[model samples]
Target: MQVSNRIAIAWPLATTAMHERVDALRQGGEDVIDLSIAISHFPAPLPVRQAVAAALREPRLPYTAVGGAPELRAALAAKLRGENGIAATPAHVIATNGAKQAVYEALYVMTDPGERVIVLRPHWPAYAATARLLGLETVLVDQPDVIDAAFLATLPAARVLVVNNPHNPTGKVLTAGELAAVRDWLRATGTACLVDESYEKLVFDAVHLSLAACPDWEALGIVTVFSASQSHAMMGWRAGFAVAPQAWVSAMSTLQGPITAAVPALTQVAAAAAFGIGAVSELLADYRVRRDMVVALFAPVAWAAVAAPAAGPYLWCDIRALTFDTQGFAELLLQRYRVALMPGEALGCPGFIRIGFIADDEATLRRGVGAIITLGDSMARAAGGHACSA
Candidate 1:
């Protein structure tokens, strides 16, 4: 059997690879402390669960339109306009099965083959995969906590400029001034700015401003993709939407029809309710406590350090001081210490490792950090290393 070249070019995701390693370690009687995946440690909000329950109790099990129920889109549109100051109507919003699917649809609708799109790194891995799958070329750029204006000017005019704020894995957020600059810069070059605010609700210590709010932004192609999956802790609910110009929304609606129909009616209803509640904030506070606790364990040691994430639930740490690459340290720690973390290379940052700050109990998280430090010290000492130099 023959598979396509796109599938062949894809790098198997690091998170899934770690899961297989974890299973092997577990069968060997090792106790594992997991920090690999990004699943929220909290349950869905009460209203959302109730909505799903209500829908499940119904007899229809019927299909919704490809763009989802009008009620959910209206609720989302109202929230976008009233709160975020983004000019979106129900006509410009579509609820797909999940945020990931929404992203894929937008990319497909907006892209022509071989078009160049700028994807800022250390990013979620899927962004690159999606580009490759569509035969679209991705120009990988690095904005280490937002680059200087001079450096950004060097890029060629692009078809689209992609960014993930309140970022995944690294959990960094771009400031308002920076966002405005990107909007202006991209618009001037005729590049559509696709600002992914999937982690928008995860912003803990900063304000998140959208490119859509920039002057004449809609006319210049500013698109924002979002989901209740992250905001409402509703991953399984698979409820997501994209906000853009009416034309783009119409394209997305058509593309999503057979690809991934509208999200379940109950999920969309619950997502509408999610917009009115603070379940996301309350849950973030809990995760923040875990983040602080985990960082505290590494704080005492000078050899290892965690750059406190501005948002979401991850700790992206530089571990190259102990080894040549992050995977060396991650693998040794996993084999001996039984703690799993995402290597930064997977997120496009070499020599760093990422730990999900809220994946485990506070006690377990603390212990895992300690194990990493201890194991790292030994490895660095034995290898005549860099990271564990105390």
Candidate 2:
């Protein structure tokens, strides 16, 4: 039996990998702590839950329009205007299964087969997998700081550039100036930039600067992807959409129509309510609290420094001082210490690992950090030396 190449492509589901590795370790009766998945174990705010419960009562069980319910899109329009200062309307947005699907649809709709796309490395691995599905050649750019001229200069032939702010693995938030520089390059070269703001609302420090905020960026050929998963903890609800020029909206619409007609109408209603939370700042406060706990634990670990994730709920750590490559080291931790984390290599950061602060329980967070530190100490001891010199 033969399957299409697109379906045959290898996709690294990070959370699944963590679960499998941790499962094997536990089956062997080894106690393990999982710090891999970027999902919040905390409950979706009560108001949001109540909203979803109320939505279930509506006659939204049937399919809605391809772009999504008009009301939800309108609410998102208000959000874009209020939060990011970008003007949008429901007509220009097409809701999909989730941000991942919106991103996949962006790639599918924006490029034809064999077209060139640029994914800045230390990026979500799924970005690469999604490009490969469409048979697109992806040129990767690796950087440790804000996107620069050299980075933008590398993708000379790219038709689209996928950028994730408060980046998945790295948790680096580009300022307006940094994004502007890239936008200038895109305008000069006529390259399309698909900015993924999946974790936009999970910010811990500063407000997320939307690439779509600057008027020039929107005109320089840009598309934006957002999901309710992180912000509203609506992962299971599959609430995501794309905001783009009305002219190109048809491409996404045509692509998403046959796949996911729209994000659930009920999800739309629930999300609308969630997005209006006046107390939503608590989410950021909680993420920061957990992030700080992890940072404090790793501070004395030696040979490692937290990247100080300004916006997202994680710390993109530089750990090359301990491991040759993160994957092997991470696997060792899973097998030996039973602690699972996402190896940085998957994000194109070989010497690093991405630690997500999804657990809201302070005691659980501290315990998880302790397990991680113990694992690191063991790994260091096995190396015949300390990772951090005292």
lDDT of 2 by residue, 254-298 (tens): 877776667667777766776666336777777777777677778
The lDDT for every candidate, in the order shown, is 0.77, 0.76
Q: Best by lDDT, which number?
A: 1
lDDT of 1 at 390: 23
Q: Which candidate is the best by TM-score?
A: 1
Residue-level lDDT of model 1, residues 277-323, one tens digit each, is: 74366788887778777776777555666867878767878766655
> What lDDT would candidate 1 get against the real structure?
0.77
Alpha carbon lDDT of residue 53, candidate 1?
82
Cα deviation at 327, candidate 1, in Å, is 1.9
Show the colliding residue pairs in model 1. 321-386, 321-387, 322-387
Q: Which ten residues in a row have the lowest lDDT in candidate 2?
A: 274-283
Q: Candidates' TM-scores?
A: 0.92, 0.91
